[model samples]
Target chain A: MDVNEKYFKNISNRERAIFEGAITMGALFHQFIGTPINIKSAESLEKSIKTAMELQPCINKVEIEINRDILKKIENEYEYISLTGEMLDVKVESNFSDKSAVIRLKYISELKYPLMYVEDVD
Target chain B: MDVNEKYFKNISNRERAIFEGAITMGALFHQFIGTPINIKSAESLEKSIKTAMELQPCINKVEIEINRDILKKIENEYEYISLTGEMLDVKVESNFSDKSAVIRLKYISELKYPLMYVEDVD
Candidate 1:
């Protein structure tokens, strides 16, 4: 398995205290779960957000910004969800976008220091 | 559940790609798993290292440094394994020591950037 798969599997089991505590943190840590950003069209974007909310009810807010390149590439194929987190900001890139996508997630707890950014960089 | 427990549980599953990838990273990411540093006496320290080897056969090298305060506190009960990682150094403190214990682990892979320091800071 690749690093990405391993990372996801590590957090797959909620039985672990860390995973459970992350959930208990609620919207502060549980705010993410939006639709795949590579898709074009307002309907696809809406569907992604809707699907995200269905999986995670704690997500009260979601803000997505699609660039013109991504808006154009929706007609083709996307390779990966490129993600990068530096300092505190998250930047994402993919074959589907001319410009990178940025998402910011903030929390109230101190545990936030360890997991500051998560990008879908493919 | 506390954040500590949740974090551990999330990574408990080997099925996740990230967890398995960490394993595949081998000594680069698998250098840790030594005897708990809080243990006192050369015998206990030896035992901890021994137990660590048994759990992770891939560990080819391990260096340990015990200070005077930790050596002295071995006679009493301690509370936690305080650990801090900043920049590149790792500092560990516990009820067992007057001075903090420090350990550094390095690797060859790029993923090393993500997991900088992991102190037993219980």
Candidate 2:
């Protein structure tokens, strides 16, 4: 059975693009948020997250940038901090048919919330 | 700034409920997927995931069950295995005003995908 035909026939291509990207963006945030990390481990962690999330359906790319500034200031006894939404800047690109979208997760200081939104669509 | 007024006014209450629950469900899956786990740490990991996800906007509660059968059989060199979506069964409950939704993530063997869907709404 065709997975998309069975599970995703209701939504339009644009909506599917958004849906897939949203799921991935949400997945990226929650999946990596509590991993132990310092400046030294940041790059490897970022790479791992990118590779992992990209495996999801319709996901073409996952770009992650963990805040190095936050990692640099770590003074805890453990010498590393659990990752948080505030430290993540992410863009997940997904496509369904001719439509595609980029979903972004970024910490917005004004609201003090990590905001996820549709950054681009086509 | 009024976050709901500014960022969430476009979606209906039911949509917002589904959206929030979906996001939380995705976050829950990704955030803890790679954590080192064995039967001994499964309960603690489940508790931690539930507590952390319950803090998200509109999310009322989170329920997590990590597969202990898989953990019990672990024979890896490290004595533990990284958490994977196949090992998780989760529900995220979210409400926006009178609208509420429960999003679920469970692995389906036929699809070979950990599916996320709106399990319930009211």
lDDT of 1 at B109: 35
Q: Grade the docking of candidate 2.
A: acceptable
User: For residues B47-120, what per-residue lDDT tens digits would candidate 1 score against the true structure?
Assistant: 45434533432222334333335444443234222111111122222111122222243321334222324343
Chain A TM-score, cand. 1: 0.25
**lDDT tens digits, residue span B1-122, model 2:** 87778666655677667667767777777667789999998999888888998988889998889988889999978889999989989988889899887777888889787887656777
User: Which residue pairs clash within candidate 2?
Assistant: A30-B31, A31-B30, A31-B31
Give stretches of model 1 more than 4 Å off.
A1-54, A60-122, B1-54, B60-122
The number of clashing residue pairs in model 1 is: 31
Instruction: Name the candidate that leads on TM-score.
Output: 2
- Number of backbone collisions per candidate: 31, 3
User: With candidate 1 superimposed using the best TM-score fit, by how many Å does residue A65's alpha carbon deviate from the native?
Assistant: 9.3
The TM-scores of all predictions, comma-separated, are 0.21, 0.71
lDDT for residue B41 in candidate 1, whole number 0-100: 46
